[model samples]
Target: MYQLTLGQRAQPTSPCGTSTDLRGGPIPAQPAHPTRTASSPARVGRRRCRPPPTDGYEGRLVGSGLSGCRGGGGGRGGDGSDCIDALGRLLTRILRHMASELNLEMRTDGYVRVRDLLKLNLQTFAKIPLKSHTVDEIKEAVRRDNKQRFGLLEEDGELLIRANQGHTVTTVTSESLLKPILSADEVSVCVHGTYRKNLDSILHQGLKRMARLHVHFSSGLPTDGGVISGMRQSVNILIYLDVSKALQDGMKLYISDNKVILTEGFDGIVPVKSPISRRHLSPSSIREAKP
Candidate 1:
């Protein structure tokens, strides 16, 4: 059984229909995993769960507000923190990468039925099974997510959930997943955060989407009041983009529902204009900083 433990929050919604695949066909029923009834003996003597290996993923729980977890019960923190964290990571993977592989019907706009998602037999590092997760628990997890990585929608009485951005599925078109920024003024400031180690390559080759679908940018600095998500707090380098310039150059820029600035980066390469090498500076400092 896969254990349930806290994992790195990964860096990175919709409506409609009776849980159908991208091709609009009904999803095959997933075989159910055996369940432990309330009378079952509790498994004990298991070692305390450890932090998951860093996968370069980013994001943080906004708060420890989860009241309970259904699968395997208590987490490492003994307060459902582990279970919620694990659930969030699992949701990210399935929604962003494995929808096709798992045969879970993901719509073109990147939404999957909440009921369909809860049917998978996945588990956490603590051996907590995901099948036991309640819709309320899943809802709570997404709500408390600091990055606002997921968006929830209710349609025709069915709950739908989706990742706001950072999708690898090519069929999930930007036109479907993101809202187009029609004017540069739609976003006041656009900045891409990175590390010093990547500065040289980025300065020369520009920022690439790498494995993800779009290059992410923030509308403001992490310290800025308007900033919610998009950039990680640990990034030491900040590359500010001229939104107007990019727009004028015929670049397509988009903003996720969570307020993340995203773009294809002018054919997978967003040429860097100037990179600021510090993180503590204010939003206005980017304008004053020299290359």
Candidate 2:
């Protein structure tokens, strides 16, 4: 976990400021680039954040920093859409992976005060400062997000934000971060999505929670009305779980604020069972895995 010194007393010792590596080592300075003449406006725009990889957890973290952009060219705040997109990605990273690392005390349910989040001396890859971001911009990011990945609230007089699910931090527990589905009848459909390439491994070894606290499931299919989070839009393979059976067997399951179904699984693995079924995205296709 990288701890970038927060609070007013910390001063920048480098081009942006003193930033530590993930291991807390001093990051080396980069070589100087040729300066552009004033007549030629720098054409750099904010670096677009990358999407999560197909294999999901095995993939490296994406969407960490904004790439430097300037003027009408790519740069932080230069393009309205680009700025919001970058901001959304950054928010996701902090709320999902770096709350503890950055020392922004998060609630057990995973919310962090928007004011506290704004205090961090965030920067783009081009060293563009991000501390100027306003609370309204943060609200816009949440409103525009397609996945409904973030949840926002007004506690007393302060605004708070949190990733709806997909947490990797040890500090957040399933009991704290999620709403339990006490009755098996509460969940009509619980499906996990994945790429067809991972199908064989999943069938053989069952679904592992990977680096996350629980295996994520969707209440419905992508095309199903009211379905938003949980499964990715691009997944071709869906694994249907017997939530009732799992519940009857004493396994626990939960639902996040964004409606994602979750379970730690029995010993962290959802074994193949007779009630569990596999289906392609196509409506006509359905099959059961061998128990």
Candidate 3:
């Protein structure tokens, strides 16, 4: 919930202007470094650091400014840490809580208008001290998140943005959501990890979507990069999905672009624990908890 002030007004201030600290106090200036003479040995091999983008022009242009274009690099446009973080928080809060308020049809594919989001105000963002954001700043936030939570796309020459998944609102009409687990055998090992304490209740009551639209699972654990599905890493209890049985029982599942497995448990699915289910826990927890 940090207040990120990007693009300070063109008023009297230093060249880079001043960045504020958490306490709303100005950050102290750094001690001036000694100027190096032309003969200084250190200057021989030193590479120059690029100053941050002014008015958003950059060596990496497509990914900078308000153009809504794409390019390569380490997923940054410039020294934009504060703006990106603010936009990211703003995007998630809206898509999850206020997506439909602005009259967009969000789908399982996660496409919405970048311009619409940029125009969001404190009313939508729980009144987070929002300043105006540009299209590029929003896209830069999407790239830095790297979770694929939000994305940018081109449709009929217009640029749009969306939350990748984990939507509690906004109906998704993506092709993936329309299809069932066509090859259950290929997804035979899908699983969800949880803390050791939840095993007893989970084993008794079964996994539920709870507040979310679906219960997320990964193809494997985080080391494999599939099961990272936005869960905490310390999870020890692994809930294995019997996709075959799940489909056979008339349940549905969707696979996200990021390879995360998703399911909205069948109607009345909660309270109906599977009698024939597969689950595992870390070896160390086996002795500490019930089998």
Q: State TM-scores per candidate.
A: 0.71, 0.69, 0.61
* Candidate 2 C-alpha lDDT tens digits along 78-147: 3344555656767887787778878889988888899898777665333333465667768877988988
| Tens-digit per-residue lDDT, 1-291, candidate 1 | 011111111111122222433212223333233576774432211122233332311123225433335335335435566667767767777787778877889888999999998777666543456666678888977977888889999999999999988887775889899999989779877777776567678766778897678988887767676688887665556676767767887888999998999988667777754433333444445444422
Candidate 1 — which residues are off by over 4 angstroms?
A: 1-70, 73-77, 273-291
lDDT of 3 by residue, 1-291 (tens): 011111111112334324442212233333333575554322111111332122432344444463322111122444445335545765776665467765655666667766665554431111122324566666677788856676578888878877666666636653533245666876645666565556567657667666567777766655454343544344555555667667676667777765677777765233334443333434433322211
Error of 3 at 241 (Å): 0.9
Task: Mark the regions of model 2 whose C-alpha exceeds 4 Å error after superposition.
Answer: 1-79, 124-128, 274-291
Best by lDDT: 1
Error of 1 at 178 (Å): 1.0
Clashing pairs in 3: 107-172, 108-172, 108-173
lDDT for model 3 comes to 0.50
Alpha-carbon local distance difference test for all models: 0.66, 0.63, 0.50
The best-first sequence of candidates by TM-score reads: 1, 2, 3
> How do the candidates rank by lDDT, highest first?
1, 2, 3
